[model samples]
Target chain A: MESSRTILTKIFTDYYLGAAQAKKDGKPIAYVTAFTPVEILRAMDITCLYPESYAVVCSASGKAGDMIGSSGMGQFAGDLCSYSLISLGMDHAERLPYGGLPEPDFMVATNNQCGTTLLWFRLWSQRKNIPLFMIDYPTGSENTDQNEYVYRQYLALIEFVKKQTGRDLDQRVLAQQAANSRAACKLWSQVHVLNQAALQIDAAKLANALFPIVAARGTPAVCRYCETLIHEHSRENENAVIAAQPSFRLLWHGYPLWFLPKRYPSFNDDRFQIVLNDYTLWWDLDYPAADTLESLIRPYTSTYLNWLPQRRIDWTEQLVRDYAIDGVILHANRSCRRALAHVIPLRDHLLRQGIPSIILESDMANPDYYSPEKMNSQLESFKESILAA
Target chain B: MTAVDPILKNCRSMVLNPHHRRAYLQSVSARSCGIIGYFSNYIPAEIIAAAGFHPLRLIGCFGSVSGPALCDPMCSFVQDFYATQCSGLADLLTGLVFPNSCDSLKVLRQVWQTRPDGPQCWTLDHPVNTDGPALLYLTSQLRRLASELAAASRSTVSDEKLHAAITEYNTIRGLLRQCYAKVEARRLRYSDLLAVATAGLMLDRNEFTRMLQEFAGSSLSQPLSGNPVMLAGPLTDDLELVGALENHGACIVGDSVTNGWRYCSQDIATGGDIYTKIAQHILSQASPTAFDLHRPSLAARAAELGACGIIFLNQERCEPHVHSYVKCAAELEQQSIKTLLIEVEHGRPGLQARDLMRIESFMELL
Candidate 1:
């Protein structure tokens, strides 16, 4: 009869308790990323945190609006990508509220989502004085007949990990982990499919997505969490919404989901269900490794970012269709130019494809760059466009 | 077309197209006027269109399109003007436009923000269209600009006129989108697009539209070969650059640059919900590459645009995009996407020929 919050408290406590143990043992507790995958960092028993999740935490609250405008956020204002700003803004912000950069033995970053995060991480790690490991990704453009390049990165990552930990990764264990992660993602994808039709996004279900969509990618835990989320979604009841989801369903592109949660959470009502997010989709697809530790870092086993040029367009088109999403909201964040870089073209692309996309402008971590009331009005137009359609 | 067609060389003449003088320049000639625009992307296309004056891309070519001048930083193509010193393309163009993008373009604004011997140049002062201080500042600025433009043109933009202007602008946007779609699908070559984008120089929406619509209707077929080169370098890849690619039997396909995609949008609605339209347009235009830091970083969107191989171009000593080009090269390399980073400067003709030969070699790989 333990309450859900109580159970979550326990889970969080257990993880943190485990974290406390690592702290006691002087083992590093680095913040890992869905920018790459969960298993790569988990393999070494390092305490991991997903900035994507922290971004979500800010998304559910109005905290992100306040968190922006830090000196670090301003440094990247018109230069890097918005997600980098979000990660940096939040990463730096977390140090103030959630305590400074977590103590970590080593830092692992990836070039999966446009090398911005990797670049940002390089700067971040350098500033932190931590050992930095990068997982090279395959080019996302025209392919050479050689698939070896893709998997080559996987092997490289494996070697890097092994060198750092001084313990060779067992191929059998890595394959098992990959299988589990992929299975979890499949189920996560299915759960996301449920609310594809403007179904209301249940908060609990969204919370559950963290596991399969994020934590459990490349593992059975993802599938289990997805199934549980679906069950929880079915049992949920909502009457406040016009139907179950909003009249218009949308996806918040880039890192502003965290920045503008308070401004636009109204869209999360029962009338419309936003079943997927760029943040969630990235990790679910970019599981860094599959077979042996060496095989995992193979260049052919590239990241989602550099594996194919049309990957974002492909992903966006697929998500809009899969989720039957009506529109896209590009968080034209100031700091993370990388995230917002192609947003206009993507908007243009979506517009050409007849998707009603809107760019929601704001600084992911800087309040000086946002207007809640005005943003709400803009979203209203977006929502109205959905209703009108 | 010669071995190197004059894209950057005659950019100013292209901007100051006679139509602009026959219409707007007569007015500017009669009386002084303030001008505002972004260096490369915006380059006062719409403003020139509205003011009935000539709008220029401001690209410069060294005496020979043969050298490193073409490879200067992205902004160097227009705002930097190292080539203007030699090419003398600066004679036709006057004034500047600075909007929010990268630090390189922003600094250009500072340089012009206090020009003592030029047209009363102004900054549009538009920020990203998001709901932040930038938006608020830009909203106020837009209102001021509407009035300023009216004063400059000596014709107040009535609410009706604004609405019509917006719709007309939207038409241009729709047409541009059509062209981009064709480009995205690889149906059109970048060289074919040069005329259309060039037509925007000093041409009004109507004239540019006529040229664009004609091209859109016509069948100007160019093939993108096996090695569909996706290049990012200095400001060399202008219309002239596109033509150069086409001349070499390479179709300029997709691109990831401030002016390439970030600049796409219809005119803001003239009347109701004007702020929203302007907001959206500005936000869409402020993609990552807009800001040019000394060592700028790669935009994820560039990585998202798949090309067989990437060409990183930069102007020597440009500072910003050069660093960005290097970082982008490393990133592209990590993805197993081979990259050739080229450095160029204004007034240098020999370097461009070598770069072209080098490009031919790189294209051979794809």
Candidate 2:
């Protein structure tokens, strides 16, 4: 049987190659944010690509520095979101993975993840002279009006996709896509639940498992990949003897350091096991079963990032209890201000609850802002304090 | 040399000192129903006034606070606002209305709500598009804000009251435009024009209108004498940058900042549903960098203003303006216009020596 890592790599490689071919074949391709409702585009046969995921690939492949430098030459400030900087830099980048993403026919973005997405995508829309459709997600408490607004925008977005691609959305295909998304999400949630049972899964393996969920959520490939992940974890657990539980279980509370995936192993040792991260659990939503257009509104609007800080704090405390997490590692990503804005208050809230947490300041895609020596020293001190507690 | 008028002098003092502005707000709040603070221009000040509350635009303060940081990498404007709130402004205002405009302000709203004793807070969600559906959505948000304000102030917003507020604000906008005309004609200094506009945000509407009417009609001796340049970017309360620009031989003929022309360029129509008209006015104006993609060209505006160069004064760590500057600078360069980009830190007392040197060089190029 093929390992899950190989399966994921194959899935992603095929996806990117297919996108490139679609560009060559003159098919419609839209650059979309990760939080956009892509199933609607998929139903219309419009190929959707994620610049945010592409940026992560560049960072992991060690090409982000060059791309970021190119962006600086274009006058984009280094303080802007590194994901956006890398994506913008790709046009002038000397080296590109997959020969750079094909020029998008159009762009779709949602502000649910961050406000920077709107600005970043708008830059492309203006530069390319392509139509850009924006979906505004109201931050803070959810109301019926907010939900209704989002639902109507989804309807409008479907029309926009149709107009851009000259393809009609098939209701049947959309229903099937939603069902596939729900199944994959269920399986992904089960994987996290399994990790809670046994602290044996490595953090890097889980991070590797995030690609399919983020990239292929509305397709059957994601369901298959998630099933393989579940099977491999269970099979490995059954084959080995009872695993020794680590002394400390830590929860990663923000976006992963994509530039340093290899360093995740340093976290899984005799003293600590990274039980879970909020980034992987972002899509573990209870998608409605009806599979109607209206059904998607709640699931899309109710992502963890869209909630207010208080709600997020409550959710984090619940996760700590549920996973028996000993401490938290907050990634104060310099590139992402929206995510970083709530970190201080969240840290204070956790400390008041008798939970120890430490903030690691770095950029997810830009390694220039990250200091390994400083991060290591902070981690060492955090470990001693957790052990002392 | 001519002596400064008392009205302009008071406006200048208020702009230079936070204490003077706080005292002015206190005096105004004592006579009015209450003072309601708003963050962005997207917020309808008319609605707050119609609710019998004096609307004060909260241009954040300067300097650091002596507490744990609320957020890192936040624009100095928002940081200073949070610092001021932490200091005492939270208790001084009846309520705060935050437009869901930028990421930092949105998160700051949420963080403010986590405080049990924070002022009554409301968020006005803004739509990035200006189509019919967006207009309808924004109108709905305006109506929601009206209801929120009414409940807080215990006063209703009637159509008559709203129209009256609109007319008063429109008058203020007209008077400010006349003042800008003086700047264009080189009859008034641009720095003085900015101080008056900034003071207008904090003063009572009626008092500001009367003061501005007198200033606009008064004869001025000091004339602007330097190379004309248009200023564009986000909300900047840094008067020092303007002073430094003019000191280095640059005339600020016009601006596209939210606190300047963008705030008062258009008047809300009084014929239609008041909320819808307010929505249309906001959506019609040149959008702030964070709000819309299809913004009116700053280069075109600079050309119209007869300025040879543009000074893009962006607050440090402000993502929207930084991203917009790249595109705007490119467009301006294509048009054979000179441009200078200055990233200013808000809490800092004055312009840095390097920034001053850059301004000087940019002026020389013009």
Measured against the native two-chain assembly using Cα atoms, what DockQ does each of the candidate structures obtain, in the order listed? 0.02, 0.64
Q: Write the residue-wise lDDT of candidate 2 on A174-287 in tens digits.
A: 999899988989988887886676775567667867888888888887888877677766746465333467778889888888888653426435778787887789988668
- The lDDT values for all models are 0.51, 0.81
Error of 2 at B160 (Å): 1.2
Candidate 1 lDDT for residue B323: 35
Question: What DockQ was computed for model 2?
Answer: 0.64
Error of 1 at B272 (Å): 68
True contacts kept of each: 0.00, 0.61
On residues A1-389, what C-alpha lDDT tens digit does candidate 1 reach at each position?
33333444444445546666777887756666555544555665556656545555553555554455442534324434444445556545643434433466666665444445455565556546777665433233322322443344445555666776665555455577766765665666565565665464453335434543453355444455556555555435342232254655677665533444333345534565454566454444533443555444432244443433245666778878877677788766555423433555577778889888888767655455567688778877887776776
lDDT of 1 at B180: 70
Which docking band does candidate 2 fall into?
medium
Across B36-136, the per-residue lDDT of candidate 1 in tens digits comes to: 33355533344443554345444433233322221112243433353342343333444455543444444343333323444445455433223343444
**Candidate 2 lDDT, tens digit per residue, B1-366?**
334478878887777677777788788889878888898888889999999898988873433445445556777777777877787644568889988877888778888888887788888888877777778888899988888898888889889998999999999998888888888878888888888898888888888898988888865567768899998888867887788888899988999888888877777788968889998888886554244422568877887789999898888777778767877877888889898999877666766889988987888888
Task: Give the range of the ten consecutive residues with the poorest summed lDDT in model 2 chain A.
Answer: A235-244
Each model's backbone clash number: 85, 0
Q: Which ranges in model 1 have alpha carbons more than 4 Å from their true place?
A: A1-15, A28-31, A51-95, A145-147, A197-200, A203-208, A215-221, A235-256, A260-279, A286-304, A307-311, A326-328, A333-342, A363-365, B1-366
